[model samples]
Target: MASVRFNLRLVAQSHWRSVHRWQPKRWLWGRARCCMSSLVGRRVMLTRPASQAQGMAANLAALQAVPILLPVIEIAPLADTSELDNALFALAAYDWLILTSVNGVGAVWDRLAELKVPGLPPALKVAAIGPKTAHGLEQRGIQPDFVPSEYVAEAIYPGLGNVNGKQILLARADIARPALLRLIEQGGGRAVDIAAYRTLPAQADPTGLAELRRGVDVIAFTSPSTVHNFVRLCNGEQLRFPDLPGKPVFAVIGPITAQALADYGVKPDLVAVEYTAEGLVAALLNYFESQPLRNSL
Candidate 1:
């Protein structure tokens, strides 16, 4: 895992320099009229879940690019909430409440509301993995006690301070990695991971699949599940990702997603250093600007 992360860092450093060199009139957000010309009229396929793809689609459209929505993964509340409900009712017993994604934040809050729990206990510290998750908590009038410098789950450990003899409750996806929980346990923290939600494969959208068959300029992935589900959907339709000319450029929001693509023998064309929708768009603009020929395709 260390070696994998090290390789990802190297790739990030290489891509960061390229993304840093470009300066669009309004890189991430502003009037579409002021956006860079490189992405104008280009078709970018967004592969996030339905609920989460809107922001990225809006961002792409605002940049004057054609956004094709193709939801690959669906986020749903788990049917069996008894386990999570029990965990939330005993929230005060835990020293920390760790949320790993915006979905997790939503699930935890929904359960809390259903259970009639007003809010988190005053003494319990809260940790959010990224700005987006932290912002979700903030929307509910809760301020996180800690957010790591890096957006990844592995980066949240140092901010947690001494966890010896501490009890931590992690509200995360059913398919979440065990890295964070293992780290906490190794530090003598009693970490209980509760499934806040389930990630399921989204039924393929006919329009989106047709657009993909015709070809797209770029395809963006935000998570491993998206990458996996995309390939699954394509395979069901007898389509395969190829390396021919005019093939869609594969762009990912983070190294983990990039690694997911790599696992399927697909190397990402760009990886966002910031690991957010805005960052992904910025990287796309920068990539197209750098490779002017891609703009024509």
Candidate 2:
């Protein structure tokens, strides 16, 4: 049975090689390695707002995936900024300014410039829900006092210290969830939730829609709003997802976005370990590399 044992050893070696063709360490390489990637030539559909898709698109492109920009949501400034203005005018009265997204930071700063507000109050603490949001604040020479390890709304409360008897200004999207507001209120803080920007359903780009109709390999959702807007746009346009051949893989940036997909009787094939564009791309690479092993088994 020595020959039989030798044959099994060879078979195992071959399987191992196939499974680990692409190593996670190689993903750190700055240059494109598309020639050796399973994601090479794969068409990835981006469903975030057009303004936000560029970075993610560039990441995918660097990895040699064809990024089809099918922005399902648009971020627009509120038509009536009266309340936003009122909040900004009295910024010194608030104890904390909570920003959840890059879009929120942009909206707030744009209004701040309009109001000729030089900067935030010296005593006013700032909190960001994620590193990306924190980076946005940093770009404007403002450093956040609190940034949660977990990038979700629920995670922000714990890092916010004692909010008891404090006034917190939450600048967020028009359709933002009430979880953060509820959390602050439960902790005895008065939270003013303002619509910093409007997340509206975008008219799908014709070129991108055409590319999608031809068939894409994967679709990525960054937020719940993207998922919701994607469904709304698809249904409103009479495009039946069930009819699409060889259903594309659904990928989400986080659990919340995945949950949004699940609400519509859909499940994500990949969820990013980190809720960021780079994390999503890394997850996709890891996923595609394991396909051979999955198929072999």
Candidate 3:
């Protein structure tokens, strides 16, 4: 009986060890750890009172229960339509069409539809920097042939493989980073760039800004302009949730936006592993999962 009991204990210990090896922590615990870790070495600059900070956890809980409401912040035209038009005309002659943003896809499609340009070249293939742009293409009755698993300029560029002597047309925002275009040129591809759209800061909506100030559990900034506009609208007003510096989660889609947050003295709670809306959403979900204690409390 004693020997059997000892063996049973050993088996139980081994089982637990194997379980830990396979799943380091349960889902809830994992989230809590992530949230805690992200905050450990960060600084908090609360413009609000201590009571408001503590109330943030409760506000977050309530916000999580509600549906995500997205507000349109801005819409504007590209700086140079002539350049865009010329680029689209070149599209039918190029070997590849590379879209870096959903805005790019929309701009090109809208322009082409307006011009009634007929038929893309048979040799031309489309590539999107990320899933959002790919989905934008799908909505226009087109499909992207390539989308990288990781949605960053660096990641997407390498996945293009060799493009030596290939003609590639890149459509993007007026303020787009030059990394992808530089990479294409370096890879021996003849790259033509066109500014598809421009983004302007949205008019300040006082009511909406007040609601945002009241308490936002998670603030998502999709672009640098959004970050700039959001900050401009809010100014230096004290937020309802003060603990946010330590806990309130801020998510950004790309490095440029992430840097913008830092420049504004707003620490991001989560940075998307990739540069796309899909990746942003995934990163948010992952962040929520990591803060089990905060979520459960």
Candidate 4:
């Protein structure tokens, strides 16, 4: 009986060694499979009619291993359309158009379509803060002339290089932070700010939050509001494995969101080097690679 047990243990050890040898390729395959699985039966919620939720869905699909649970915090129209309309008109006059978020792009695009603004100015150079925002612009047939290597405003600020005397239009949410605008102004550029949309706090979805707490391995936060609202919704609830601070990683898009997590007393385990969904996905994958056994369990 002792000899038989020893033989079984040796076989198991050999099998594990083989698996370890193939770990790198297996990890890559696992990520690919996850991405494909995420897209199989997914439906994108299109809050803004003109919003490129489909494109966003495709982008999400490509990052399947990241485990993003998008419990939309809130979706609302631009509180004021007049200012957006004026901003679109001003777009034609400005030398540059800056888009800070996907929502900002959608709001501005919807307003432009409504007002029948001829076409984006031919000479207007477009700048986007991240790849997703840049993708939003591309879907509208406009290519961004400037996108930062990093997704944060601080990273993007220096890349603006020299915009002295440049007329720039920044289309963004009503409650968006003023970092971008402030940077543009500091660069000697005259910036006209327009509030394209407004984000209202969404009623906490208890059922959804419950499922997330129970099943999700990672939580991806795109903005500070999402983090704040999500935490508020989960207030009083205990996490599945609270003892492990990094068990279910909190992945943030950029420093702003990382700060938001910090403010809520939750430090993110991973933050994307770039502020786009793809970047977020890559960061998550890298984290998994570094901690394969933790992910497997």
Candidate 5:
């Protein structure tokens, strides 16, 4: 009996080490630590670009949640950067440059760096929709003159203060909404919008369906493109949303993404009030922490 108890203890220790390999702080002083933010057994789906999904997955893992990578869309460089080139070469013409996404910042800066473009004209000011966008510009040694309190274009366009007779350069994805340009023109500003990158649905296998067939807790959509591409893939694969096991909660980044989901006649379970990565994660945590779940799929 004594030897059997000792063997069981050894088995428990080995199992604990294996389970906590990625989570080293699970035990302290022979007591199991409880983290308020842990999502330990939850598997959440992420529908962002493939290249951008890893960072989010790392973040999820930090919260003790499993990140299900479901990259529905990807950003591609525009074949014709001629228009973008013209805008870059004539940078002095624009009074304000607005960058809405990190992809835009990368594409624009890549070309500008290739030409060894000098400092932006003192007369020109730069605007980024959010911190992430600003960080992208900062990496290229440029700082935004302004970032709106809210990350949406609705807030950005109106917050520009006075734009009477000012020329604005809006560099963004090929399929970006034109409302910002319309807003600029409505504010008495002439705008030159250029496509720095093109967004297209990525060709990927619809993985994790078998897991979903069992159940999933949440599916998060980060963009309108992601919403569209995901639904498209589901339809093509004959994977109906209603068939998703457990009636998993659908989390969307912001109002725009939520509206996209609504277009497909599906309502989101949660919409982030703040549109950034941190905001989405917080929303997810808020949801599961307040709700109970079954022990397993």
Candidate 6:
């Protein structure tokens, strides 16, 4: 993961190389009409869940890119959040509270609001993995004490620093990975993990599938599940991301998302430095900026 920083420029260039090898402009859209912005007239495929997709869509539109809504995942509340409620009810027992995603922050905060929990426990500090997560916590009037420099699990435990014997509460998605929990425990901290949300594959509409087949300029993936469901939606039981027409380029949010595509034998054309919404958009524009002719917008 550390080496990723040094290889980013190489990866960005490598993606351009791949794009150049393809029938020129098939992916870049030859001779696009400029709209006084870098992304004017570009077709950007947004593959995040619908609720999350709106924000990204507006961002793209701001840059004059036409956003194509192609949601491949859905977020739902857990059938039962009793466990989470119980943990929140006893916040005093914990020394720290951990949140891994914006969704988790939202879920836990929403529940606390329902229970009318106070701002936050004074002694129980909080940690969030990403900026969005921390920002979500802030929106609820609870400031997170720490947020990992990097978004992945590998960065969390270390970021917490000297958590020996500390009680930590980890509120996350129902299908959240256990790696973070194990790491905290290994560091001599007692961690309690609760599920605040569930991410399920959303049914893809046939119209959306048909548009995908017709090809768009770029397909943006924000998470691993989006990549998986994208393949499932396009390939069905055959279970493979189709050889999408129109020479679409894959722009991922970060390394985790890039890795997800790699698992399915797909190489992302570009990966963001920061694992946040702003970072994703900036990275995509940077990719286009690398090519002078493509920069005319």
- Better model by lDDT: candidate 1 vs candidate 3: 1
What shift in Å separates residue 33 of candidate 1 from its native position after superposition?
A: 4.3
Better of 2 and 5 by TM-score: 2
Instruction: For each candidate, give its TM-score against the true structure.
Output: 0.88, 0.86, 0.66, 0.70, 0.85, 0.81
- Tell me the deviation in Å of residue 84 in model 5: 0.4
Least accurate 10 contiguous residues by lDDT in model 3: 40-49
Against the reference, the lDDT scores of all candidates come to 0.82, 0.80, 0.59, 0.62, 0.76, 0.74
Error of 5 at 2 (Å): 79
User: How many steric clashes between backbone atoms does each model show?
Assistant: 0, 0, 5, 0, 0, 0
Say which candidate scores most in TM-score. Answer: 1
- Per-residue lDDT of candidate 5, residues 1-297 (tens digit): 323321233354344335522232232211213454646667888878767877667767777777887777888988878899888999888889999999999998888877788656656778888667866766666656667667787778765789989999999998888888998998899989899999998776447555555667788898899888888877877778645766778999899988998998888889986677767776777777778755767
Which whole-number lDDT from 0 to 100 does residue 113 have in model 1? 92
Which pairs of residues have clashing backbones in candidate 1?
none
Residue range with the least summed lDDT across 10 consecutive positions in model 6 = 23-32
Judging by lDDT against the true structure, name the best candidate.
1
* lDDT by residue (tens digit), candidate 2, 186-211: 99999999999999888889998887
The TM-score between candidate 3 and the true structure equals 0.66
Model 2, CA-based lDDT:
0.80
Cα TM-score of candidate 1? 0.88
lDDT of 2 at 253: 91
Q: Over the stretch 173-276, how does candidate 4's per-residue lDDT look in tens digits? A: 77778887888888898988878788766654555454454444566777887777666555545543223323556778778989988996777888887565
Worst lDDT run of 10 residues, candidate 2, spans 1-10
Enumerate residue pairs that collide in model 3: 31-289, 31-290, 31-291, 32-290, 32-292
Relative to the true structure, candidate 5 reaches a TM of: 0.85
Give the CA lDDT, 0 to 100, for residue 142 in model 4: 69
Q: Residues 1-297, candidate 6: write the lDDT tens digits.
A: 423322232344344335322322232232233434566667788888877888668777777787888788888888887898899999989888888888888888788889998756566677777666765765665655666667786677876788898888888877777888888888898988888899889887666666676667789998888888888787773433646766677899888889889998888999987676667776777787654323211
* RMSD over all Cα atoms, model 3: 14.5
Off by over 4 Å in 4: 1-72, 159-161, 213-215, 236-247, 290-297
